[model samples]
Target: MSSDPFEIFLVATPGLEAPLAAEAAGLGFEPEIQPGGLTVHGHWPDIWRANLMLRGATRVLVRIGAFRAMHLAQLDKRARKFPWDQFLRPDVAVRVEATSRKSRVYHAGAITQRFERAISEELGAPIAADAPITIKIRIEDDLCTISLDTTGESLHKRGHKQAVAKAPMRETMAAMFLREMGFDGSQPVLDPMCGSGTFVIEAAEMAAGLVAGRARGFAFEQLAGFDVAALTPLRGAEPVTRPATQFFGSDRDAGAVRMSGENAMRAGVADWVRFETRSVADLQRPEGPAGIVIINPPYGARVGNKGPLYGLHAAMGQVLRDRFAGWRVGIVTSEGGLAKATGLPFQPAGPIVAHGGLKVRLWQTGPLGG
Candidate 1:
């Protein structure tokens, strides 16, 4: 990474950029919501911290260099003289990807080829398609900016949750939604229709102050001058002092309950979270203070029949209104009519979020007056 203030872009899942930026800003980083992600200025340690501690970012990129390249010839000339030795080692392999928009250098394949050859020849680094380190170059309006993807795989993998349900929610999206729903981990979180217990597991981890990336490795570990000694502090486990408050989840499927249990165990928060196989109609709040209740129920696009989903939503709403008084509620679904079928007093629907090629929105309710 660069010395003083390198540009770090936190990739957000399109519609959730604002919440990611808010989470970053709350962590004391100066965050600006850009078109696709949140941009922040930070040094090398900040890069490590963002990858290890940030729950909302899908990937982190460090801008290495930028210039104006009118054509391939100019791009090649600048690429040859660029200081490749500063950031990459001779043995490290890299994959290059390029995008061109409204610029004279419009051929993306040729652009990637230039970077690949340059790194291979000048830096003596091999170019492989499956390399952990990737060089991403963007050419827009004759301006070319080069960045390195410091995150290898997506951060949502999180090295836990080996078991997953169909169309499971990404941990990155779940964390941002939790933040949007004012979840600070101080109170209990219940996901009645929890598919794989994403919300409940995430809440327990947050309350335990667990490092998001501790269980996994990052692309930054493959970078030059990546001292394991220097990265030790960032990887050190903070004392997990979870309060008496517990997180809860229940799904009608016994398989889902078992999967949730296995995932929480791998995440090292099984002691703080509880999961059971129970239908929403039989949903009852456990013994504890009233906390947030969030659910990502199927919207007929994927799982259940449209006709029967209305009754399911109505049953969920009835159970919440009857049992979960003083608890905030948020539901993520694609159908507005289904939300209305709940008969719960909901606030305005939130932004439409893109999920698996479909658009979904979050409808929420304040603490129940019932």
Candidate 2:
């Protein structure tokens, strides 16, 4: 609300800071790298652009302000005096979460309660943990910073997939992987290890100029004083399209293949992609010159077998070299040694994401040089 540029934070995978920052800059806001995200100072328009274009971010948060409090009394007084009506509505339920370091307010629950009371007393809103809106509080070195999560559900839920496999790729990760692979989706795309067809589906959607946020609702809609009508027009824009021979995917598990088919239907992209069931070892190249190929094979930790996964990687590399020359490949894996076992010339990619507590990296190759 203040004319001062509001601080916007974009939470992203650790190694993806550069790409996310570049994306933010492309949207006309210079972004700086923070611990777990990218930080940009901007207004509401900038916030909207971030939601519209960011491919690597998990969530977008706007920082209202920060205050230093030596103790609970100081925290209470400052929090109570700070304006609350600018964002909250009396009818909306809201909750607070706090983290601390070197401050007297060590207990997280106590801090949350006092902060909740301040908001309730000042703005007359009840604290509801199940409320749609969540206010995040961070207390470090006696400095308290408050931010509002503009993205209610994680951005990964693109609202298209009605079903998923055991370990489907999240929409956010799929988008980032596409960018890392230089995918504009003008040419052919394939995902042989496509569990739920997320990569292929996302590529098809992007190629068709479908805006990720267009089909979904955001937490900002519930915030006070939002222009719902303006947002509606943005989401209502028509989708772009091209000929339908571009995207394809396959999986070994029959159930996964069926689930992918259902998901593609729900995403309205069944017409855009071809799905089938085939083991990675038996995967074949598309009947075209060259394009992008992405694979999110089962990591050992998740699937509980490292020996066979190594064989799958070797077989995948062999198939690509022998049959898919001139094609570019992007492989997502959480294990460093296993990625090396593929025996492909790969460059270190954007980030190492925390998927199920294991570090994952995107390993990519240029067009196979025969």
Candidate 3:
């Protein structure tokens, strides 16, 4: 909000902080990883770019200002005097959220109320519970940090995939998991159990060099200091390029396969992706070079009891081992027993990624040998 570039926080899925930081660094950002996210210091342009290109971040936050507030009275006094007019406009609505710790102003509701009143009365902005613009307040060790949520919705929404299957994998997690497998988008990707084709479409988009956030509008567009002229170029959608290699996905259920094709069409990667109604046991390698085969198999909760999943996983592993020569594999599942059932040469991946309230780990294999 100030002339000086504010610190940007890129929130990642809790277990995937490292890969997200690596992604930010790959995009030419100097990022420092914190507990739950990565921190980068850059101007507004970087904020726009981070939202547009970085596929792994769940939210992008800008640290507008910080101050010391010991008590509620002192907090109210300082909040009223803060120069909010420079950043907030009277017409735009705002929502304030606060957290307090190790300070006399321990009441989060009071802190939120004070800031809300300050912005409303002093800055003349209407306070709305569902406002697009959000002001976040964190009071730790008596130091209050005020920040803005530039990304209104979670980045995983991606404005595509209007059609989704049960417990679909988020696009953010798909992108990060692909990155974790060292996928630069050049190699072909196949998801045999592709629900809505999340992995395949994401791979197709990446290989075509598409911008991650191109399909959606962001909260920053509604901010007071937003410069339309400056951001216009960045908002331009790049031409969808033809990928040299292709991506593939398949599901046994006719409805899931149909949904995948529909979602792929919506994502503008339908031409580069192929979806088929094929079960995992019947999966075969497509007409492409050696590539990555990733699948998010159903656990006990979704499909049924764990007893049959072992044989299902074993069949998948055997099919891949026998047919898909020289290909690598990534299997995501909550149970290690299921992953081990694959009987592939899987080396342990780094962290247990949490998805849909279930902890899952990615088991990856190097290229297969003759």
Candidate 4:
């Protein structure tokens, strides 16, 4: 609120800090990678831009201020004195969440209550459990770092993907995985087991130069000093030219195909993306230059029995190898053995990423030979 550059944290999916940082850097931000996220120093517009443009960040947090509080009494005293009106609005409700590590104030609930009460009484702001604005308090080694969640829902919600399939991949993870697979949005991308068309739709959006948050509203819009007109330029008025290279997705389930098409339409990428109900064995290379084929297939952990999944993976690998020449492949699965069953010449697997209570990795390959 002071118009000074502050710390902006781009929360990354675990094990994917590098790709997220790369994305941040590509977006003209000087990103410093941390264990689970990256930090960039910037002003309010920078925070707004990050919330709008960053596809890999799960959420963006702006560090408002910090103070050293040894105990609850000191925390309460400082909380009452802290200037909450600068960032938070009295008309908007807020939620306070706190975490304590190796600190005297070890009770997180008490810390949250103290801060909530302080804001409610001092700033005349209402506190609610389901508030759109979130104040994050991290008390580590007795140093309390106060940050605000500028992203209301996780960025993955993207707001347009209303129809979802079983064990669907998050859009944030999908974007980073596409980055990991070296997708630059200029070439064709196909997902044989495209659940809800996440990869295909994301690729199409990237290719069409669509802002990731264009269709969604952010929590930062509710902040005290937010200038709505200032964000208009970031939300460009330039019309999107359809990409020449098409994005494709296929699923054996007709319902999934319909869902994919509906999601793509909602995302405004239907003109550039195609979805169909087809099994992996029936997959044929579309008439075009080869590109990337990526799939988040069942890993037996969630979808179904593991025994038949091996055959499914093998069949998928066979179809790609036999038909989709010159295309690179990336298969995401929880079990290494399932990835191995693909029989594609995969390079060493990428980092183990946390997805839906299971650990998964991307098994990638160079362009397949004839």
- TM-score against truth, every candidate: 0.97, 0.93, 0.97, 0.98
- lDDT (C-alpha, whole model) for all candidates: 0.89, 0.81, 0.89, 0.92
lDDT tens readout by residue for model 3, 1-370 = 3578789999989889988998899889999999889999998889989988898999999998899987888999899999888767789899999998888778899999999999998999999999988999999999999998999999999887888899898999999899999999789999999988899999999888888888898888887778878876775466466799989999999999999899888888888899899888788888869999998888786667899988999999999999888999998888888889989999976598878888888889999765
Question: Model 1 clash pairs?
Answer: none
TM-score of 1: 0.97
Q: Mind sharing the TM-score for model 2?
A: 0.93
On residues 25-110, what C-alpha lDDT tens digit does candidate 4 reach at each position? 99899999898899999988889999999999999998999999998999999999999999899999999999999999999999
Sort every candidate by lDDT, greatest first.
4, 1, 3, 2
Segments of candidate 3 deviating more than 4 angstroms: none
Of 1 and 4, the candidate ahead on lDDT is 4
- Residue 150 in model 2: shift from native, Å? 1.0
With candidate 2 superimposed using the best TM-score fit, by how many Å does residue 248's alpha carbon deviate from the native?
0.8
Winning model by TM-score: 4
C-alpha displacement of 345 in model 2, angstroms? Answer: 2.5
Regions more than 4 Å wrong, model 2: 241-245, 348-351
Give one digit per residue, the lDDT tens place, for model 2 in 1-370. 6788898999987666766676667667888898888888887767766776576788999998799988888899999997888888877888898888788777788789888999898999888878788899999888899999888888888787778787667888788778777786687899998888899988887787777776677878777888866666556345576644669999878888888888877777778898888877777888866898888888788889799888878888888888788998888888877777778888876467766567788999888977
